[model samples]
Target: MGLFPRYKRAARVAGAAILAALLAGCSGLGSKAPPPTYELMAVQSFPRGVGPIRGQLIVAEPSALALLDSDRIMVRLANGQTEQLANAQWEDRLPKLLQARIIQSFENGRRLRAVGKPGDRLVADYQLLIDVRAFQISADSNTADIEIAAKIVGDRSGRIRAARVFKVSVQTDSTEGPAAVAALNDAFNRAVVQLVLWTTRVI
Candidate 1:
């Protein structure tokens, strides 16, 4: 028929236009700005170590759910749904960042003769196991909540020594990226401070 070739030509033109649009969209995505990066907060100073530096600790990378494990900052809505905070991310994966900060906190506290990850090869007295339960801005981003369970196990005996959960909440002044993160930092600082105090007292 006379019309067949005409219809085929139009279809080719339309397909070409669609392909061009998709390529443009992909290019736009590739050109988008990178998200801002943030670091986890750590306790700066701690009460002087008691009698002597006795305990050696190995801080394991924390265990976390996939939802909380990503570098993306998360906010839990009042409706109990979670969403990533727009345009911001962590400097590293959540567990990795937290683990480093925890080691810093311990070293700063000076209660341990040595502290490091499993790779450190320290002749450790105890190993610290951590499980991250929640780390997010909650209640529609107006509050920061952090929770973690920690356990001390005898490195030589492979026996549990002590265990406890730590949790803290700090009210946010604003849900904006910087302020929200500040609040989270405050909460995390509080939690780690308590964790340090407890660890020193126990072992």
Candidate 2:
């Protein structure tokens, strides 16, 4: 009877040890660290041009496809498939991010008297509508491509005064997160500059 009790206690101790090890393994598996986050570099300024618009201009949030609307950094594979970078993300949704940057670009140019978004309560003279056609990095060639279509509508007339599509492709040395994002930023800046200049000229 003494031996039996001793054996029972030993078996219980072994079972507890096994349970602890299993719990530790499960914890380790669950504790996987997330990937790092990245943000699009904002445009500092565009070249100043003659002040073309003297009234408030409202910038709308650009529209994009479901895949392009997310914070994921997109990549186009050689096989023509689209995928996002592993463990990397954008600071904001693509449309919102671009809208803020476009407003900043106009501000930097100093060509407009005022610029704002939809809810700013600004009595706008014109509205800038944008559609994001392509904003992604090409994994096969290691390049960044940005395409945006812009339209300026007269607030009073409610008619589109001008429309244009701006496209830019910049070669990157690597498809890695940092390099690719840098390239995308450069391309975006170029596109924003063009859009700002064109909008000012037409509106």
Candidate 3:
């Protein structure tokens, strides 16, 4: 009878341990949550009066807007440390981002017949080729510096129509990454506004 009592107590303890383990397993099975997702922001502006530049193709780097490289050196937090932004998506890659910004600025200017990528079959009168050298927010990040070298070539004549390098800096107090992007965008906007005005006169 004494040995029977000890055996019963041992069985009870083992049963309790198994029940606790099962409950823990069930909790674990139900604990997972979905990962966060981000939707890219579409290029903003009106398409009204906007069409392919009469006879030109605007080609931009496809993956520039990605955290990935975009030929243009983007300003990043410098200390050999990186922090991922929560769930924000950008409109285009580096070159494409810059191209779209340029396109939109021109759209706002209400100039040009058509402005688009380079693959169309139409005979372009002028082609604007761009190489973005640096678009960076400085160490203080209070200002954004943008430098771009571009050439406008007459398609049929194959002559360098208008070639100019643009460098512009816009002041801002924003220290955030998105704010830095916005400042850079603003600088680009002003520079393109000037370039388009000049181009409209020349062409």
Which stretches of model 2 miss by more than 4 angstroms?
1-28, 51-53
Residue pairs in candidate 1 whose N, alpha carbon or C atoms collide under 3 angstroms: none
User: How many steric overlaps are in each model, in order?
Assistant: 0, 0, 12
lDDT over C-alpha atoms for residue 101 of model 3: 59
Instruction: Mark the regions of model 1 whose C-alpha exceeds 4 Å error after superposition.
Output: 1-30
Query: Which is the winner by lDDT between candidate 1 and candidate 2?
Result: 1
| Candidate 1 residue-wise lDDT, 1-203, digit = tens | 99999999999999999999999999998897888998887899876666876788899999999998889889998888889988788899999999999999988888877999998879988889999999998866489999999999999999999999999989998765888889889999999999988876777
Overall lDDT per candidate, in order of appearance: 0.89, 0.87, 0.59
**Higher-lDDT candidate among 1 and 3?**
1
Rate residue 168 of model 3 by lDDT. Answer: 94
Highest lDDT model number? 1
Model 1 residue 118 lDDT score: 96
TM-score of each: 0.84, 0.84, 0.59
Measured with C-alpha atoms, the lDDT of residue 86 in candidate 3 is: 29
Clashing residue pairs in candidate 2, if any?
none
Q: For residues 1-203, could you state the per-residue lDDT of candidate 3 as single tens digits?
A: 68999999999999999999999999999986632332222234433434434334453333222444433234545563333432333443456666655666655555566665566664667777776665666654467776777777777777887878778999867645566566766786666766675665556
Q: How accurate is candidate 2 locally (lDDT)?
A: 0.87
Residue-level lDDT of model 2, residues 1-203, one tens digit each, is 67999999999999999999999999999997867888776568766566444667999999999999988889999999999987788888989998887888788778878999999988899999999999999988889999988889987789998889999999999887788888999999888878877777776
What's the C-alpha lDDT at position 172 in model 3?
A: 64
Worst 10 residues of 2 by lDDT: 46-55
